[model samples]
Target: MELQFFLPMIPPTCTHQEKQVSVVTGKPVFYDPPQIKAARSKLTAMLAKHRPERPIKGKGVRLIVKWLFPKGRHQDGEYRITKPDTDNLQKLLKDCMTEVGFWKDDAQVCSEISEKFWAAIPGIWIRVEEI
Candidate 1:
């Protein structure tokens, strides 16, 4: 099946219920599954290749630390990727989706990407403002 993709700039935000207050008070939230999956898959592949031998127990992919760590406390603060990282992932997703003839409107692509990302990265949060 074909999957569509989009590259929308999302603001840095928290996913915890306490932080969700901003998302709740601000704009409507939307998520995309396909694009997210593609992007996440691409990221996973990259991480695996570059960070092979990293421990993966309960805390997702561990690179620097020794032994497995339970996903650390959110109080440690939310994780945010750089713009280049986001752009690289988006390009990879778009290329994959385009091959499957899934490229569509911007909103649809963003939703797919968000959904996939959320599923792949547990505890990670993403908040986007509606256009």
Candidate 2:
């Protein structure tokens, strides 16, 4: 089965790698900052409406996500090769997808294709399929 959808909103700038760390009780603790928390919340809310009836399982799932940001000085549909690495962006999105029941675990997604672009219409394009 394949699930695909487009979410019309500016993709979050904050990535999962933005997690903050602190020393508490002489131990290291990791936490998300306010901005990161907000990003996650927004992503979760948007993804909730697209959740699959049953979480995808196994290790043969494929996920394709395209992040479209506002076209500032760049041309529409042009690839954004700058900051907020693709892996970091995918991390946060996959986490939210998991939280919203897109899959039993992100590990089930063995094949992934992620890209970022500067677009006239900002949004996220998501495609999930079982291989």
Candidate 3:
């Protein structure tokens, strides 16, 4: 017996009304105090140990972590950090670069390193909202 797969059809009117739109006029909010603190702490720890030849540039790992795990409102309507399951994220990044021969023998460009690091992990997402 042969099986057939049918694609679902979406109505034009339904599609048109399903889209969401919003407008706001104001300055963008910055990171929360706790978040900034956590990021700084983590960055400091990483820097103290690694001591890369060049500066990490921009917000460095902390900014990347924030992007990876955004903040959202909780049940009490209070904003909280949506932490990422970075378990072994660092080791995985290093392994990936080594396997790809990008950093097999020595250090690579900071941009390349960051790119490879982010690529190793999938399904990680982050978004920050002001309290």
Candidate 4:
């Protein structure tokens, strides 16, 4: 089975973990930044709406993600081959998909193809399928 979806928003890169001394516990704690939490929440909600009625489960699943960024220095339809790299953009998305039951778990996704491009329309497109 294969599932495809488009999310209409500029995807944010994974937020780095921040360590701070807890006021109550007096111990260092790691937490997601408020902005990152909000972004992940939005992404999660978007994925949840598009998730398959029943989650997919199997060995060797493949994931494809295409990110379209609004034109800035790059022209419309240009391949965004530079920064705001793929892995960073993928981290939150894959995690969100896993949370929303896109698959039994992200570990089952054995193959991945992710790309970014400059487009007049900005959005993220994703596909999950059994291989």
Clashing pairs in 2: none
How does each model score on TM-score? 0.25, 0.97, 0.22, 0.85
Q: Rank the candidates by TM-score, best first.
A: 2, 4, 1, 3
Please, what is the whole-model Cα lDDT of each candidate in the order they appear? 0.30, 0.93, 0.26, 0.81
Model 1 bad stretches (over 4 Å):
1-79, 82-84, 104-131
Report lDDT (Cα) of residue 49, candidate 3. Answer: 37
Q: Residue 90 lDDT in model 1? A: 42
Residue 13 C-alpha lDDT in model 1: 26
| TM-score, model 3 to reference | 0.22
| Winner by lDDT between candidate 2 and candidate 1 | 2
Leading candidate by TM-score: 2
State candidate 2's TM-score: 0.97
| lDDT top scorer | 2
After best superposition, candidate 2 residue 70: deviation in angstroms? 0.1
lDDT by residue (1-131, candidate 1, tens digit) is 21112222232221111111124558765543554554445544433332213222222111111111122343222333322244443444334333432223323333323322211223322222222
lDDT score, candidate 3? 0.26
Task: Tell me the deviation in Å of residue 5 in model 1.
Answer: 11
Q: Write the per-residue lDDT of candidate 4 for residues 1-131, one digit (tens) a residue.
A: 88888889976754433323354567665667777788789998888899888777666689999999888878988999877778877777788888998888888888999998998888999888888
Question: What's the alpha carbon RMSD for model 2?
Answer: 0.8
